[model samples]
Structures are given as structure tokens and as C-alpha cells.
Target: MGLFSFLKKKSDPADAELVVLDTRLRAGEPSRLDSEAERERQRAIARATAAKIDEIELAMASDIFDDEPAWGSAARHPAAAAPAAPQAVPAEELPDAAALPASAPAVEESAILYANGQAAAAESLLRDSLQDFGRHERLPWWMLFDLYQATGQEAAFESIAIDYASHFETSPPAWQPLLPGPGTPQSAGVAATESLCPVLDESIAPRLARLLASNAPLVRIELGAVRSADAAGCAQLLQALQTLRKEGRELVLAGADTLMTTLRPMLAVGDRASGEAPWLLLLELLLLSNREKDFEESAMDYCVTFEVSPPSFEAPKRVSTAAPATGSGDRFLLPALATGDCAALLDAIDAYAAGRDLLVLDCSRLARMDYACATALQGRLRVHTEQGRRVELRELNHLAAALLRLLGYGQETGKLRDSLRLYPHRY
Candidate 1:
């Protein structure tokens, strides 16, 4: 039978939600751009993206069990058809397919194991498939990778994903968020207790959505049992918190310290190359929980301690030979940005003009910044504006100026001193 026909005959309720979301997004009128524009824009993009995903999924479903394993056809496809260049692996990277134990579970059985929350059993099943049959089936390896991610086994996920890509010469399927399950709604201010295992992939979002759907004023997420987390978990946690904040509700992370501490190192590993120190998830938590002091302090410590910061614009440092670069009044000198400097830099700015009416920041020798820095800088500017302070950012670099402009800082308006444009065309 054709893919669509098969889907019609074999109905799965789990797939229904995706179809509903897609349909609603496609049919709904676009919201007001100025206020609801960004959200609506995102929905439109998601609907379009899902349409493409649907096409791929339909194709996969149609030929799930073709005459030969579907993988062989994919491997023989032209290189241009692939999304990324496949990594080359040594011969010993994967166990030989033919050398499998007779008792290895079948792929169909493994899916049942996964659905039953038997992650370990499911993992073993897929690994046995790889060992017994190798890349004859691409689906098994993708399933194994998902298991690894869900279990918070970053190293294992990386190794298997690399090997799988090398063997198949194709990128692995992306980890999807958790789907919304039937959840019993509770009253406002009721704390929800969710039993969690190691993995925090896409599933957490859907789960949290159901809990938050109660529209509770305070949603206390009891994470007393969760020991570890992955990037997906952290991201979803942030998303959950942000969603709550938007609704004027509070998401309290009960017993979050231990899990967050365990997650800190993993996040650091991911940030090594980027040099954007301090996990945004952690920072957002501190900010929303009203621990601004702790957030600022941590941000400074992370920035100052890191060796390499992400790339940003730099303004040459001017020696105070003729006059102090900042005006004679109480002013602060913006420091050169090294790796992880954004948090501390903002702290320094705050410290310099704590109680002053006029705050002057000398950006003479500013260097190296990324989007994180830009965002923090914009935040600080907004804070100053709220406080009714006269602030000036002197000798700003071209890149910094451009970033501020893109962030909605206006040069034409002299009233909003939150952003200042000095040296109209500085290189």
C-alpha cells in the first residue's frame, strides 16, 4: 500500500496532535506583528517546516519494509542528495553485522520496549542489531542514538552518532521533543510531581506544556529525583520557565541545585569552542528567580575566567594622554572582551554607575563580543533607561553600533539615551 494509504489504515493517536498543530497554524490568521508578530511568525515557519517534514515522514512510512532494507538505496544515492559530508570511520568502528548473538531482539520489538519506558532494554536491542546486522537498517541506529540522548549519555550519543554517520554517509535523525500526553489538570498553585529518568530530550517540553496547561499561578517542578540532564533538558527547562514568565506565573524549580550542578560540567563541554561562558539556562533561571546579584556575580566570574570569548567588534583603547576618554564625571571604562567577558563586563558597568544620574561608558578599547554580549548590553541599556539615567556609550565600534541598531536602539532619537551613537562612521 502507498504511505498515505497505510497511515489511513493504521491510525496512531500520537500523530494526531502534530497534524492538529500544523492545521491550526496553517489556517489561523496571522497575529498583530508589533506585539504578537514574532510568535505568529514562528508558528508560520513551524507549519511550513512541518509540511516538509510530513513529506519525508510519509516517504519513510511508505517504504518502511521494502523488498530490501531501505538503507541500501540511500547509501547508493548521489553525494549531492545528502545534507552533510559523511565522516570516514576505521574498519573496526562498528561490530560486524553477521556476528550477532542469536537472542538479539528484533527492531519491531525494540520499539515496543521504548514505548514501555524500558530504555535500557531498548538500547540493548538496538546495539545488538548494530552488532548483528550493522547498517543494513538505518532506523535501528537512529533509535539507539535517541536512547543515548534520552539517557543523558552525551559521550555515547556522540560516539554512536559519529560512527552511524560514517557508516551510512548521512546525518542522523534529529531528536524530537516529547509529545503531549493525556494529563489530568490540577487547581491553581498546585505543585506537580513528575517522575523523571536521566534523559531530558524533546519530551520534556510536551510534558511541561501539559502541566502548565492548568494555568496555575505557581508551578513548582519537583526535580528531587532527577540526577542529570542533557542540552535538550536544559533548553526545555528554560523554555518552560520563559513560558511561565510570559503568563505572569512562576515556575519554581524545587530541588534543582543538585541536577543543575551535575548539568554544569556538561554545558561547559558544549561551550568550550564557542567561549560564550555561563550556560544561558542557568543565567535565565537566576534572573527569573530574582537572584540578580548571584547571576551578575556568576556571569562576571565565568567571563573573566574563560580564555577565549566569541568573536565581536572591538574599539581601540585610547590612552588618557589628553583627557580621560570618559567625561570628567563618574564614568566607567569598558574592558577588552576575552572569552566569557559579557557577564562581568555588564557587572562592571553596573558597579561604575550604581547611584549616579549620569553614567558614561568609555568603549575606547572594547574588543571581541558575540550575540550574548550584545543581548546583555542591550539589557543593561534598558535598565538604565528604566532608572531615568543619562548614559553615553562613547567611541563604540562599527560592529557594536550595528548590533545596537539591530536590537532596536535608535540613533535619530536623542531622548532615549539608552543607546548613544558616537563617531558616525567608525571602522
Candidate 2:
């Protein structure tokens, strides 16, 4: 046959058989991956096309193919007829190939960049992954964090951390660098009176109580000597900071580098039992460390993540101003004393104690008391004590008395001292 006729000649039976086998393979029957024998058979068929067999094998091993639903015959599979692009995806918003959707390929590519020390490139790609896949996809964020660190982009790192916190309504993972003690530019020298002993988990509560009771506007915590701290310890530290913050006081951490190195991982492991977010503590630590950029970012992240799409915080519209207490006795009657209502009790005390030098909190009607309530009340009372005003705990039932005493509330040795009294004929 002439060369042109030979080129247009029909395929032989073997070649036609190969073509049909390729079609079957391309159909991607669910049964193909269901068993080793079936997969082997498909592999054997792919071998018929020596030139394209590698491509076929590679396609079969792909994560995209692996993710395909394999419920039935390939011909009947819904994906077989599905459109290539989603109808709802805005054309402009479609991510580039490097910004692969929640797939292993994207991770692998980013890992390659990181391994090659192309941190800026990795950072860019990972950021794209975050935008493309949405904030809930955590891997990109985690990967981007390492890139930021590698490049020493402290400002950028902190900015992203803040974004992570805001996106997650939680603190980003802690990456606390060690602090240089005393002589570091960030540290004001430890004051003899302000310096605290090394903080331990067991001491956190008692120390916090002392700080609040002393009503010091600024409490310095010396953490240089601490080698380790657990989640509970971190939580207590956070709680103390929060207490001070709510009362418009401040806390300073001295020698915090080592302490932070120890606490970072512990806090990151997660703690919901404290009924508080760990990030809240991390943010406080960030703020105290004078990582102002980091702090601002974290604060921003915290605010956006947790409080987005909300009006400013306020008492409910139905909530009227607390009515003026109508009594001459300077006794503040608390309707409830549970942890949830303790603040209300404090407000009531403040309202009635307006012009009086002394105020007695009447717990006869106090329906509940807990460690939280006792601590909060004690903290508030300590502020009054600092101002040379007297506040008393009176008419407490056994439970309330026990709770207050356990919390170190008494007029004599207790923070409240002789100002604290059990109900008459009750204890």
C-alpha cells in the first residue's frame, strides 16, 4: 500500500481490543477499586497501551480519583455526568490551580516549597489556599504560620495570628519565644515589692486571691524560675489576669520567656473544663509581653471571630436600670449569689453603697454560692478596701459562710475580716 494509504488503514483486531480495554478503564467502574484482583485486572488492561499505561496508573492513584464516590457501576455514577465546573462558583472567585481545594496535592506542593526554604512562596501559596478553601480549613493556616516564623516576619506572623483568632473565635496556636530576663529592653527591672515567687499550679489561686485582696493596681508575676506549668495552671493565670482586667487593673509578667515556653504547648493542647478559652490567656500573655503588634492583632482576631455581626454589647432593651434600694440601713440584699448572678450582687452593693462609708451584704436571701461567686465578691470588696471603704458580709447561711470562708472572706484575718459574719443562730 502507498504510505498515505497505510497511515489511514483501519486498526488490527489486537489494537481494537486494546482500545476497548482503555475505554473500560477510563469508565472508572466502582468495582475496579473494590478488590485487589479487580484492580490488578484493570492494571493488566492498562498495560495494553504501553505508551499511555503510566498515565493511566498515575490517574488511578490520584487523590482526586480516590475521593470520587464509588457506589455503583461507572455508567450509572452521578459524577460520570456531572459538570466540570460548579454552577454556583463565581468565575472570578475560582481559585488558581496552586490554590487547590481541600486536597492532598496542595499540601504536597506547599510542603515542597517549605522544604526548599521558599518561605515567601510557600506563604503566598498557603494564603491562597486559605482564601480559596475558606477559614475552616486549618492546614493552610498552620502551614502559613511556620512560613511566617521561618522568615522572621514577626509583624506579619502576629497579623496572621490575629486573623486566625478572629477567624476561629479562638486564639491561634502559641509560638512564644523565650524572654530575656531583667536586662532585656522589654523588661522593667523586678521591683523588690512587686516581684512574686515562681508561679506553680497549686499557688495560682491563692496568689491571685492575694493580689486581688491587696488591690494592687499592677501585679507583677515572676515566671523566670518556673520550669513548667500545666493547663490548669495556665487557666488559673488567665483567670487571674481576667479578674484584674475586669477590675481595670494590670498584670506584669517578669522572666516570662521560660514560663511561656512551658505554658505555650500546654495551653495549646486545649482546655474546655476551665469554662474559658485558652486563647484568652494567650492574648493576655501576648499583651503583657509587650508584643503590641501581636496583641493588637490577637485582640482584633478575638473580637471579630467571636463577636462578628453583632451590635455593641449592652443590657437587654427590656432591662431597666436597677431600682434604687429603698432602705436607710446600708445593707445590700442580694437576691441571688450563684456564679451567674454574682456580678448583679456586686452592682447592687455598688448602687446602695453610693454615699455610705460602710456596706453590709445581706446573704439571708442569697439562694446560692459557689467558688466563682465568692472569688468575684471578694475581688470587688477588695477594691472598696483599697479605697478605705468598709464592706461587710452579714446574714450568711452555713453554705454561704462556708463558701466565703473557703474563699478567705472574713473581717479579721480573711480579706473581708470581722466584716464577714454568719447569720444569727445559724453558725
lDDT of 1 by residue, 208-326 (tens): 77666764343445454556666667777777766665665533344454455655665443244423322656665555434556667656545555643422212211111001121
Candidate 2 deviant stretches above 4 angstroms: 1-199, 267-277, 296-427
User: Stretches of candidate 1 above 4 Å error?
Assistant: 1-189, 192-195, 267-278, 301-427
Listed in order, each prediction's TM-score against the native is 0.26, 0.25
Residue 421 of candidate 2: its Cα lDDT?
37
User: How well is each residue in 163-250 modelled by candidate 2, as lDDT tens digits?
Assistant: 8767744445445322122322221111111233444565667656766676333344555566665556777777776566566443
Report the C-alpha displacement of residue 92, candidate 2, in angstroms. 60
**Cα deviation of 319 in candidate 2 (Å)?**
34
Count clashing residue pairs per candidate.
12, 10
Best lDDT goes to which candidate?
1
